[model samples]
Target: MILGYFFILGNTNCTAQSLPFLPDELTQVLESGLPKTLPSPAETGRFKKLPAGDGFVWLAESTATLKKGNKLAFSKTFDAPLKEDDVGFVAVRCRIVDADNNANEPRPGRVLIHIGDRETLRQTALYHKGTIGREWGWYFHPFRAARSLAANTGRIRLSFDVQPQRVEIEDVRLYVAPSGFDMSRLPMMEAGYQGREPDAPWRQGADARIAKYRTAPLIVRVLDPHGSTIQQADVRIRMRRHAFGFGSTFQVRLVDDISPDAIRYRQTFEELFHALVPVPALIPQHTPHAKDGNYANQLLSDLTNTLHWAHDRRLPMRG
Candidate 1:
């Protein structure tokens, strides 16, 4: 399968331009305000610090093979103190290779981030292309530390838990943003793969299928009371609902509630959805006290009221 990757920074004002490609070891840090040097993991057969020829460094694992459930980790005090409520974003540029070259699919790994004593974030590291000679890909994970950080000072730890296949790691870096910083606005690299091409054979087939199945002809005829077609007339069509359902599960208790917030909730639900599924209140497990006469009667009353409310508004409900 053909595979490629592109780095996309979400900057609305800047014009699009091509960026020069750099080797994995020399990948530039895209975000500003990052520390000059991040603390590196100690050298080992499975993990080592490699120099980039420039002053920069790379934490790499190139020698020993890893097995499932194997853990590799390191800790370091930040160059500066980390304050409470600060947001941390970690960017890792790495790749995994199938050391045995016998696997049918990509392997998966987990990366965990710890600030002080509490585990702050956990993200999956999917080795989508694990074959030999595959290019490296970048992954970004973000987390926030809300509690007090007086004890840990600037200390942080990172752990990589291996899956069923052997893997390699090329680099890891952390950037600390101010509290309430929006992670979605950060620059990110977009990943591309074979089937995503606009003119791919599979895409052409999909387009043809969509055109054949998802479209229909609509003809309008305006008629008079005498059963004759009107030559000059205005015909307007307004769609009330979609042929496809768009909805979500809603709490049944909210249907009978008279509080202002509940009223707004029900109104918004009706405005947005053409159908819904009543949640826990109608589920069998939630009615465990069915043997109690009074409890059963109350539940039946609430359910009946909810059904009436839905019927009055012409809302279709599933259970």
Candidate 2:
């Protein structure tokens, strides 16, 4: 993530993504947006919803067992919809608003999008990092139109892949490339031709040279909105990619957990390591440790060797 890649999803239109208004809290959590261009679930029926959040937002999906499944679909409700913007990412929140922990299986969740004819989904896994008092951040693939599902009023669905999980989601948002603002318009557009997939993302050669010894090479440094540093927090990412059908993963040691109370984590397997936070820090804004809600956004930004990546498609860090 770069300075620009990081825009409060719910708060601003940093990345040219087409999204509905973002609720205040969500912007307090993650930055950037992901989009979906999938099939028109509206073809079946209208979008579904139940009372939630101040007035209305889809109910978060919850499963009774990590074994069973729960899902809900929402229809396009924009009084007036936007056009063919290219989506790069979708950002949303998820947490065990309520839970009956029969197992440590991470509660499952998602940020799903439906276009007229196709569908793109950003799957959420159990919490890998971050505090429970605040919603954890998850980034999925950008909304794609390449193999996109068509239409305006499609479906927005969420599901619980496993059971014994009750998750809450809010501040659904997106990162889009307005349908007509074709990057082809950029004078340097020819340099970005080799698109990327989720798994084996392109790593610049020089960046590879810089990461010569590490097993995973891309390292980013996150700064707070006021431009302060977050010290010693672990950095991890779950991103949906276009190269492969599913998505990709990346991680690095950010900081040591100071509190003895531990957060059980479901590890991710990232083979094409593209980024890391050379220095990860956090300003613990709360009390008796985990109970505090006082904290700043996890300063996260992307580290890239654009020059090299522009020439190659690889995650330079993985040895």
Q: Over all chains combined, what TM-score does candidate 2 have?
A: 0.31
Residue 266 error, candidate 2, Å: 26
Q: On residues 72-170, what C-alpha lDDT tens digit does candidate 1 reach at each position?
A: 554444444345445555555554443323534332333445545324322211112211113355455444443335423444455543233333445
lDDT of model number 1: 0.48
Q: How displaced is residue 194 in candidate 2, in Å?
A: 33
lDDT of 2 by residue, 1-319 (tens): 1112232212221122223333232211113222233223322122224455454433333333332322334323211223333333344443344333563332223333433421333211111211111144433333333223333433344443333333444445443444444332221100111123233334566458746754455577878889898788678976554243232222212222222221121122223333322222221321124222212122222113222332253333321
Clash tally, candidates in order? 0, 59
Question: Cα miss at 154, model 2 (Å)?
Answer: 3.8
List candidate 2 segments past 4 Å from native. Answer: 1-61, 64-71, 77-85, 98-100, 105-141, 149-153, 179-319
Q: Which candidate gets the maximum lDDT versus the true structure?
A: 1
